[model samples]
Target chain A: MKPETKTTSFDLAFYDRMAAVLNAWKHLGEIPLDKIPPHGMMEEITRLLYLESRLIDQRRLREWLDLFAADGAYWIPADVDYRDPRRTIAWEFNDRRRLEERVERLETGQAYSQIPPTRTVHLLSNIEGMLADDGLLHVLCNFHIPAQRGQDHQARSGWCGYIFRKENKHWKIVLKRVNLFDADQPQSNLSFTL
Target chain B: MTTYSDHLPSLDHQPYQHLFKPGFVHRRLYIDEDIFQQELLYLYGRTWLYIAHESEIANPNDFITRRVGGRPLIISRHATGSIHAFFNRCTHRGAIVCREPRGNTKGFICGYHAWTFNITGECTSVPLRQGYGKSFNLAQASLQPVARLESYRGFIFASYSKDVPSLTEHLGAAARLIDQWLDRGEKEPVVVQNGAMPFLVNANWKTIYDNAGDGYHPPFSHESMLKVFSNRYGDVDMNYYGSDFDKSPMYSKNLGNGHTFLDQRPEMHKLSAWKRQHVMPGYEVMENALIEKYGEAHALPMLDASTGSGMNLNIFPNLLIIGNQIQMPEPLAANKTLLTWFATSREGVPEEINAIRMRMQEDFPSFGEVDDSANFEACQEGMASIPEMAWIDIRRHQDTKVGALDPADQLWREPMSSDLHMRTYWQRWQELMNAGATRALVEAGVA
Candidate 1:
């Protein structure tokens, strides 16, 4: 969908500064290259990303809930790499109850777009380091999403931001953020999770 | 699959294409090189082809590379805050200067000769200033700007020829649909909801357009989705396919102007009270945008109206405006018959809500194995007939003139049919196709 008119103008100056900061975040893979990401953290984060992709791709969906915090959320913006979720619309938004319902509905009954669950291989790369002020370690990564369900070869690039805190000696996801490169661009059907 | 290479290369045969009419379309329109070439000139040349939106290039030096027909185009924001789109080919050599989908670049430097141009498409530097001798002036060659570029509501459009009607005029009657979609209250601006889900379909591009505003496909075509929704909510959510099924319904409407829409949104939301809440936000800024643009009461009802999510409407040629769902719903876009969906949102609801919305959006039968089945079934079925079919029917609603279009009705002049909308599209197509080459759109009849 193309714009009908320019009704919303973002803070251009701030957007530029943010874009630069985001770009610098891309090169951050250089930092932890010498030392492998901590195994436990890596395992935990990898599981989150993997579990997220699995629900939508493999359709295991029912198990998706085990991962999220009660207040956890999911977002797919209308525009590519959309920075502020407040400004644009999202394709999906779910709290814990809603999220569970989605999986339950997909499993027990007929899901429209699920004639086949999406097949996806999310390449998580560009890991960056950020220790939050709130005693939480936030790991950032750029996700190269290449998916194929039917004829469409869905390839997307996104920046992932996750806030993790140690819970019971294991990394528990506090907040997981995904900013798609084309976040602000208009979209078609995204019947599955990203 | 054979359709990929089954093209007929000659444009000459297109003149009397109505003659050999063995089936649906004269192969030339689909497989002919001449028709493709003409499309670049007539259709894309003078039409307000969609480019990137303002949000995509929000800052100076920000750039995105997209394709217009087969030609590469560059969309960028200059320091002056003006957005510009031009052919991506560098003047030095016919090469795509920008390869990345998006970036922030000060200027374009051709890898071949290093001819540099700033945001204005001006030649700022060249690798060998002395190589051209005194005869080569840098000002003579710069990035060529599109003949006409304008954007309405952040959506950027460009045309190779300036003679076509103004963007508003070109949008003609269809602009109302855009307005209705965004008006919330009449003062609101519809912000980008979710990123686009661009997928490729094996079928022709027209299939998606033909199906988008269709009311006939849901019960059976999207049975899985309908069944799923029905199973969960105990109803298909469609007035037509729900508990009350109308096998043969009235369809095809002429919205007077070229613009039109199918009556599906009303039924989808009617499935349940929960679905109604799923339709609109508790109170949205989009409503405020509408109130600011139109009025408060207008914005409230329009945006708050309970409706099914998929209200896919298209602006002739390309550019389709689809549903703005509150949950994990995405919009389906057709790129020359290839189907991809974008998960859209109204902008910054809660992440938790967006996640559920994304799940609902992406975890559907459409994106799963069934999309291939759904689209392929349509394409294979539509094209199965002999190539010589006579005048494709657009007469679905011609019999009963009224609201709510039925996809079963595919004829022009039907009150419920958007096929009449097609009449405008065809008229525009014929005007361009008949003009032949070299006869550019001069803001009047072509050749």
Candidate 2:
């Protein structure tokens, strides 16, 4: 006889929520017409995105940390389209505390993975932003980041989704999710943020 | 300090036998194409390769596609509640049948020709019947099964060799170690959850295995992480590898047949493993909730289980169990290896318990593993770029021995940093290669 379906605290609703964001990101044009942000807001959102990449590339990591809200999360799922952080093992799922530790680790100079240090250039496109049902600004874009560490070079291309909340008159990332095209495939050291 | 054995390719008729000796492994073992092929056949092909956790396919019709010894395989649970492993290759034209990584299905239909096979691997339907004469036997066209499939606890293993030892025999006393790991489930099932963090290293698979039980590298290889833990969390016992580390009660033991494990229980049991970990997002809330639900007495132990198993168990050739995670390294080529880590959860735990487990599980793979891959790749590069460095030294604490109290037959206990595990496993590897030499010679018509 088949075993009874086991139940745990893992909420399927989280998967449903993340899946909705992914579906919406994939078909941005199908988003409700009223949800689209104003053109100026879109331009501002794009500029914020560019600045985020610039801060990371310039190694202004402390400044980059300031771009997130106090409860911010940085997630890189092992699978691209579907993820339940509570159930699946993600490549990265960092709350603010973990992100702080990550930055501290990288700055320690002894993080051998980044000892020679990784040089990265991010090219972002297909930018879109909307005021979602959750009253948060949901921004989506595609990115191609070429990173080199010593002689090893990698081209990391992926789609990024950001759930932004206005905090203290500035846009702060509540959630920054990176979905790499080869998320399901094996990866070398991804010691840097995308 | 170059020994004559370092430069010698072989001591006798066996081509690769001389490459290994007590306390040393020749660098050629890592980079030689000829040696890699033989290793795939003699070592990986013949041994019990871990394919899946039975928890993954707990129900009938559940299947997941995986690679065993670099060959594609599908491990499925049939309707009779029995598990069977089949080569994913179709009987017609040799195309892979299943494309998805995992799913529960009534049956698998090859997208190539719509050839269908049941969950038990029977050839159920071929598009048009009577296309050929009676020469096309229906039973003959069924999926090819692996020679042997067996499981202990919830771990499933498959071997291609018909004459290999039983899985129980292969595991030896190491089976008891596995039991210790499984006991954490507390009568509830321990499941290998859906997602995994798979990282590839440009290094020989042996390099990865050598480092598994070597407690010497963490202080240097992961210096930053340890520093962060101390600075941020003030947990000096997080790693137990700091000052007086050698004095710490932790030890690495070599279980016979290349199986080995690092016992950190002595050190970890001093305080709860959960209290030692760097605090994360839901730590306080989850800890309190677990305490409230299971009460302080029962909840503390469960929290420790969630924090970590505190044991790093390495089953020879492929499987490495660290804490609650199962690590399987798939050797793709001489220098390309993919290591996949599956985080696990217990069947009866609260959602908060598993949630905390997931968050804590992200610690090593996300941070520490990157440094490991870096070293592995660097080791590969150095070995390949400079052939003159013929010996990959594993001589540290090599002279350490088993005490009178210890079981002398297969068990060897040493300080945490001893290279005894490497020495033990390489001995088994050499024995396999030597035995396989006759088969290799016969296959090549050299005999």
Number of the top-ranking candidate, with DockQ as the measure: 2
Cα lDDT tens digits, model 1, B1-447, are 222012222233235336232223343343334555666666666556766567768778888877765567888998889998888888887777767777898888877877888866788988868878989888878888999998876677788766556777666545655666555422433344345445444444444445554544555555554444444444333424653333323333443324445545444444342333321121132434446765755434544432224455556566656555311111122223333354444343333333233434544423232443355444534553446633444444334444343355432333322344444445445555554343443323442
Write candidate 2's Cα lDDT for A77-177 as tens digits.
88875655667777887877778889999999998888788899989998878797766899888999999989888899988889998877788998899
The alpha-carbon lDDT assigned to residue A184 of candidate 1 equals 48
* Tens-digit lDDT string for candidate 2 (B1-447): 332133223424566767876667889999988889889888787778899999888888999999878889988998889998999999999999998998998888998988899887889888886786768777787889999999999899898876577788888878998998878636467889657888889999988988888888888898889898787656544456776565677878878778888888887656667667566556766676778878989888777777678888999888999977899988889999999988888877777777777877888887788999899999999998897678888887766443223555456677877787788788778766765665667668766
Residue B59 lDDT in candidate 1 = 79
Considering only N, C-alpha and C atoms within 3 Å, which residue pairs clash in candidate 2?
A: A9-B351
Task: Using TM-score, give the best candidate's number.
Answer: 2
How would you encode candidate 1's per-residue C-alpha lDDT over A1-194 as one tens digit per residue?
A: 11122122222332253345445544555455433456666666777666676665566655556665554544444444434433333445444444554565456445545546567776777665554445666677788867775555667678876656666665655445567776545333455666
